[model samples]
Target: MAPTKPLLLDGSTGEGGGQLVRLAVALSAVTGQPIRIVNIRANRTRSRPVGKRGSVHVTGGGLKNQHVAAIKCLADATRAETTGLSAGSATLTFTPTLPPSRLPRRPLKIVPESDASSAMLIFQAVLPFLLFADVEEGQGVEVEIHGGTNTSWSLNYEYMDLVLLPTLEARFGVRVERELRRRGWSQGPAASGCVWVKVYPVRKGESITPLQLPIPLGKERDTRGPRDHFEVESVDVALVVPLRLLEPLQTALARDIAGVFPSAPEIDFRVVEDSGHQARIYVLLVAKSPTGLRWGRDVLHSPPKGSSANPTSMADALSRLAVKQLVEEVDSRGAVDVYLQDQLVCFQALAAGRSSFARHGDGRGGGVDVDGVAGAPGPTPDIEGDGLRREKTHEPFGHGSMHTKTARWVAAQLLPGVQFFNKGDVVEGAGIRFA
Candidate 1:
């Protein structure tokens, strides 16, 4: 007889922003647990037509169609509709088609209509599941995500490369091969982009040894200009639009990048003319990392009125803003440092051994904090056999093993035999772990 699969419940699957969906899908893939969600994107506005005539042309339509296993409600209707998901903006219900026993059963297939945000979210949801899928010694999984490569409300290719990909590879030991087939943008449906991701899983999980984060190298000065060591090499800008709007976007971005990085020789930008009505801009910022971080950002707004000097003025503005943010974070000493703190959590759990991170106890005086206490014996009986045991402690604890402490009271949870600590001291999860 087949074993009964445990159901993983996501309280806010659709709540908050897209994070809920992304996290749920990622964790589901990691834990090999099937999930059923009731309120998908409950906080988001229902799908709406991008242009006039109530014609649905947005990527949300693609999402609604692709995941037919999940049912959604119209804002006003009592019954859910598989067809015409645009009846009215309403809540979505997602139920996985297969059980955990059947996951990674086949490479997941998703075809999004040039909607980068939706496509990325779908990718986040399914990628983790694929990573954990059962593969032979040398088998790799492939997923084809179709959408606008450069779309508003989505992390352009640059961020996926620099920020997202680097962090994932470093922390989770996940290696992926990606190829961008075509470019899609929000100028209209005319700009279509395709990308394929090949995922290779780390079978034994990350090394159990503790990690030691290196201090960031200081800023460097070059003959061309004085820039942060983490400075963006060049932004590969692409605008997918009608022939008329093409020149306008190019001129605008060139001007903007010149202003931002005046000393740099010139901004390396490009344009792809595919569809006339739709226009999207894709910017890939080449970083100076050994593995060359690729950060992508795009502008998917409507064409500007009165070509007066700057036709793609809005696109220029948004792109410049994104570049500024990316530069600031990459250059700042604190950005990657903060991320390292958060990312270590998953690795700690996977290590099946205690791991530590260098962090200040009270926001002062840096020290190493032991994150996972799995090796320590006998706080209680082994409950799940996932190396997780609960223990009753005289301190405050947070959900899952994260904790904080105060002098007044000791708050924590004892899950049979699990042990938690903070600053080399035992603490509880009363507030730190839960909200």
Candidate 2:
């Protein structure tokens, strides 16, 4: 059936990040609506050639060059196809041929083996449509995406499993069943992977209420170095490789984490074999937060330089790097913590009423409160609270005034609010709401 509300998505939203594709696809699946996208990744990269001759423009140039060709939807699908993409400059256009009401029985198909990055981009563009198919129509959405699963520019399968899936499930209540039919890595033998998404719409009773600022209370602990004390709900590491390479990878990861946080308990690691040629690694970290559950993923591959030495070393380094980045962002006193802040937009939008996140003047304030308990505060506290002797101590929660300039702008556009603050407690508007 034709969708009632047509969501016109700007290809360049959220710091002009490709997330516009990701969110748009996911939302389409949930809402079962057809969306039109123009100027897709319009600002991504400039047209340039690797050398003086045989030079090809980047993403934009490629699109312009393909404009004159016989552009057609690939097999009644939402994606467009054109050969000689790098032949010349052209203007490309996209229009959804099939409405939600007229969607075919067959699952959506996207075929593009040469530019895995473009394939991934297309997936994000169409993912939302699939996700909402079942929920809106009470039927499952089957998707067969053909492209590089482990390409440098695309999201590795490991990250999809370890990080992205878990976050969606925990925060937004999304359930997806997937199978790795084949493995495809960058500049290697290509293969395919299948993902089945089952979305259960929130029951009337299960709807989440909007939260307000100073969302209260929780004790916090440092989980960084060895012997550091912090409670972890779960930690799972999965590497895409053969059994022979699994053990060494696991050992290296554990040792690395131990070196960073000795006091933390042993983390669990799992290995899944991939049929493709290239190797990849994905890590998922989950912990209880004051507000709810916090989840993070690190998807990376080994640098090509050391391919000859230790196969798993690259995986280990990537895992460690992902963890370090997450911890650092969470520990910062900035207005919005990076990943969580970004992922929270969907939840905030889906919320029944209203919700607010604490804004740290600098990314250095104490941890936020869940209900009434407080986590560690940032380096310097701006507001003063009561001291043990009844004197006023510094308080981080309400130190600064509510500056909703950016948030209001987003809210005005019917989008989520995103705020930013720097080290000197100077609040500034950020283009990407979540960083």
Candidate 3:
């Protein structure tokens, strides 16, 4: 049974960004719970000089355009009621109708008030609700998000299309088909674009499959010493830049990939699209494991305004940086990128059973078992009894990025039944069923 009083959350805690609000609302809708969040996006308030000569600094905070758009879209889909659904409201109360109503058959559309708002951020906010929505069999929910597709400090469209969507489908059985109508940019000149996504919700009476990311050298037969590293089987490079810089970008990318993974087979490099503006240049490099896991890194390079920099030099620099970051990621041997690790916390908490993955991509396979409670440590899986009881002294869940910790904290607040262990490498889920 649903609780009578609304759950209260402090928006200033943890990551203290718009994502906290997004996850809170989506979980509230899915679980048919009411929530009240105070001090929303409190830490996100920023002051920057905007006027001529950078003389005056204007400060802005609270819900942004994309945040409101996501909230409204989820509210409409779930027939949920909201209080303080405005541009800069500090508090929000969201109450979803109990026993979730059936979502409409037609597609839903969302347009942010600002062209610079990230469409992917909006998509992330509503994905959980849509994945568990009450939809008919052989049917999918369509969402058309019109805003900045490649905005700064957010996941871009190509990353979603190439990395996130595929990983979700393969690991969790959640499928989403994407269609990009046009490119949007926040760099150089700001322009709005559209991305249509058709999400295939989990079937009635079924729950999302628990994610089980493979450990690098846990195999019994391949005991080739203890130093086992993550293997990169293939590479996919996607570029979007001006027509003139395409050749140099390609050349630089190829050289970097060769230097990084010369032994790896199957490298596919291509220009997915051409950015019309000289200021807009983006590169994404994804490394795939034989087990189908992917780790990706990207950079949306925006040269200094009015700087007379060489375009070819700029392209080469961007390629080198992007590839260098990717090499670091691969070297880390993480099951997913740093960003994706945190993003999966919500799913792990809501899924049907235990979901376990690697804690660190350090290539050395080991995990420190964690207690269900936060900040407390538990026993090591290999150790025994009272001797190992003292092992729980350290902060067991302190491995992931702040974003990861924030997402994990949000999941814990919304779904109390879920338990985290192994520094968030293992999740005992709520087993939430859509039907």
Candidate 4:
């Protein structure tokens, strides 16, 4: 029998990057649904300087090497049928292998051509399948990928290792690990990198758990807005820098981070070999909360032009970026960081139960997790949202408001009955299942 026609998506939706495509493919694999996306990378347009710096010309919209590479990797993962799977193609179709439970037995490998391509983006694209992969007892899926580890617009491996995965372990019960075999930078597409990941499948009959937002110690509802009380329990910062700036940048960053934490959280700093062709600085900030989970943000050092830049500026730039981001995230009052918020949207929706978390905002207040005692905010599969719907508002759930908006937009489009609210930052999953 012919497969049902897939859901058609507007590639211009949300941020118009590969996110919508990734979400669509992941869900399609799980739900056994086919999806077709038109106008790939429609949110972006091709632009080049016509002459002077101030002058530029728009040459219409198109897909980039990274976008093409991402979709291809995902297509290979599910052994899916696809059309328009080449660079610059504007329309794409994906038909997953039937039953939505089949996965590769051998280690899956995907490599990028340029250094600027994000391995993290590719990893993020395929992670959902790994989480729910079907494997024999004592067996897990292995993925080996090559791309930039520390790049703009994607989470670094450290964030995944120290922060994001840890949160998954604590909150969602996912068992995963990462091994960095080589280092890659995002200065441009020519730079190269490598990373390996092993995701242990959940036991038979077990399902992914939902995310739950904590209420306050004595409060009925959370009112913390964007900034809330998330105590910093630990701090792990890793730096891979050139030999010339190693000691200086390391020492300077450590001192700067000290002032950010008044409670004297456990802080550790390490200096490692620099990766890639050019000398660069990489910083990973993994902040943990005893009452909640880990929140991570990594800052890539902007290379100094000529001989004018010094060690102080390098350390200061990343230090400022790291400290300021952590503080703002703590204040945001959301359950996860803005970046992590994007990562979790798909998982929360795919899981089998109810999940809730504090929404992001700039105001102040408090709340606590009431799950264990109350057995979560509501029942499994469907959640009731009283806040403003995504279509009706512009408020973001967390960081990169547009990104959170994008995730919600993708979910709403692909998963019917899945709704996200503005004020509450609460989401109702589509109750997606593989059986």
Candidate 5:
């Protein structure tokens, strides 16, 4: 039975970003609970001019174009009623009309209001409901999303297709087939694109198998130390840049990979498409363990603002930056990178039994640092203009990123039976089933 009173969530909690809204609404739809979020995106504050004398004043909060789209799309999928459904709203309520078991397994489509809105973010927001939806044997749901595939602050389409989906299937028995119909880029003039996702949802009576920690075998290389590092047997690189820079990027990538990994794992150029504009340059490197564990690190290059900027130098720098970040991830000896570390939390809460992953290094709190930035892989939301700036927390607890910590917090709030221990290294799932 649905709760008579809506579960209240403070938007300023934890990471206090779009993720809270995404996870809350998805959980509400799947668990048949109603949620009311106040102070939405409160920590995300924007600065504007107070007068004409160049003095700036801070104004904060509210949903972006992509966030509002995610809530509405998920509501449509589950027949949920919503309040404050417009963009820039600071408070919202979501109440599903139908229970999880009654959600029909049918094709759904999502089109974001702006070309710059991330399709992958929309995918993350609605995926849980689809996964827990009612469906017959041999039945699946198809979701088509339209928006930017490579956005500034969100996960790109290539990462989801090559890394995220595969790891989910390999580790937790959740299968989602992703196909890219067209390429989208937010850097160069905000291009629109499309993606088709077919989900093999967990049926009414069946539940997702619990996640088990990966056993640490000996390292793939001849390292004279502990026998705890999981072997990275191969690496796949996806590079999207101008056609003129292809050979240079490939050369730099090979040199960097050899210098860092030293294990001589098989390197495959999975994607080598031309991004059509120099500003749209992006690269993703995914390391695969023989145990089916995958970790990914990527960057969408934002070239210096100058007509005199050299394309060759920028491309080389982009390659070097991506390589350096990915090497950091591989050296940490964690099962997943900082981003995926948190992304998996929701699934852990939804599954039955216990789920855990090997903590990175001594399991102390740490995060990925690209160039000199602390928290995010891309441009940390611009706080000066209409953008918001947030800080990263490194308090000692399982070494998970702020996003990871926030995700675990949200799951625990929505699913009472789910409990997290050792920071977020271990979790007891809610064992959610449609039937």
Candidate 6:
């Protein structure tokens, strides 16, 4: 086959890293457009921990194992053709035998090489393409991935369970059934861990539906409605720890939340005897809003034996991290949480129709004589001709919406027509069809 007029990509583009490669390849597979990615993961470099098991340094700077795993896994599952798919390779050319529109009839499976490699990362790459797949007549895509479930530096498994799956299902009508046979943390007692998930597409050709923004953003002269504030309906927590330690941790978290949330929001705590690994504790917190927005945060660690550890301190930190993050996300008044904002950019772009969403701003109506700023922060909400400035502290986490801007830059690079603006966020494929 002559080259497929590949969509060109630079690994070092804005938010330059593995996600760009993962997303480009996923789009390639779904659109059946052969992809050519250079400078693959150009901006990402990590030092391999001096492993006690003699794991050595990763010398070259290029595609990481997880990126390779995501591509190869999806390709193999679909019997796709490819080249330049080796560890640390700076370029990749991938051609799927059939795009996701014409998915094969079977459950696709992916297993990474290292027990420490992240399952969530691989899932990010696989999911977009999978959304367009149908395993049987009228059935959605079915897939199973076995690898690191809660590895460090990647979104943990529960975030998908608490935030992503529910949001996709409710907002987009995507159906999925997930099962976690085993859980894996980066440095736990078990050499490796696993999670199993199955995704059903929104339809055969389209995997995702366009996002419905709470408020539309197209006209500068338009009147504004009251912004949708994410209200916490409840908080559900899961702890994987030694069964004996559950009660103390639960009691401590309950007390902390009572003080943190003076409103006394409903809280549910569940404990699992297994930490999914040999670790003594892994805590997951899921806070859901009445309108279905969600924010999740978790912490997992394998403490040294008999150290100067206080159960009170550990429990306090874990619970505080979870509840506190949820507070920040909800306070931002964003339709989605901070972490979800970045990843959703790709899905919005891939939708078969125009997709729009509310991109949260700091709500300052105007800022310091903003002029001709092509990508300037939005004007303050509900303010006109007032020279009042709401002081912003240097603390970056105060607003909690970070990477959505970087996500916009990435979208501009990969898909020329897609616009991720403050208002009227849209992704249109221009009627291009692949099957």
Highest TM-score against the true fold, candidate: 3
lDDT of 5 by residue, 91-184 (tens): 9999887866666556888887888889899999888878876677667789999988998789899899888887788668888988999878
| Per-residue accuracy of model 6 over 87-129 as CA lDDT, tens digit each | 8789888877665656677766777777777888898888877
lDDT of 2 by residue, 72-130 (tens): 22214433222223323232223343433344556555554343333334444454334
Taken over the whole model, the C-alpha lDDT of each candidate is: 0.41, 0.41, 0.74, 0.65, 0.74, 0.61
Cα lDDT tens digits, model 3, 1-435, are 345578898888777888889889988878878899999988775555577656443333688889999988877776677898998888998887753336767789999898888999899988888887677787888999999988888989989988888877766878898998978899877799899999998888777776444444544555554322356767898889877788888888777788778554467874467898878888888888754567889888877778686767877788889988888887765557777777787787888765544446444322344322211122113222221221121121445677777777878877877776556666667878865
All candidates' TM-scores?
Answer: 0.55, 0.59, 0.86, 0.82, 0.85, 0.78
Worst 10 residues of 1 by lDDT: 406-415
lDDT, residue 308, model 6: 62
Task: Give candidate 2 regions above 4 Å deviation.
Answer: 1-14, 21-39, 46-106, 113-124, 130-139, 200-230, 241-245, 272-292, 305-323, 329-337, 340-344, 355-362, 365-435
Candidate 5: deviation at residue 157, Å? 0.5
Q: In angstroms, how far off is 409's CA in candidate 5? A: 1.0
Q: Cα RMSD to native, each candidate?
A: 10.9, 10.0, 5.0, 5.5, 8.9, 7.6
The residue-level lDDT of candidate 4 at 318 comes to 63
Ranked by TM-score from best down, the candidates are: 3, 5, 4, 6, 2, 1
Clashes of each: 39, 51, 4, 21, 0, 4
lDDT of 6 at 57: 46
Winner on TM-score between 2 and 3 is: 3
Pairs of residues at least 3 apart in sequence or in different chains that clash in candidate 6 = 364-380, 365-379, 365-380, 366-380
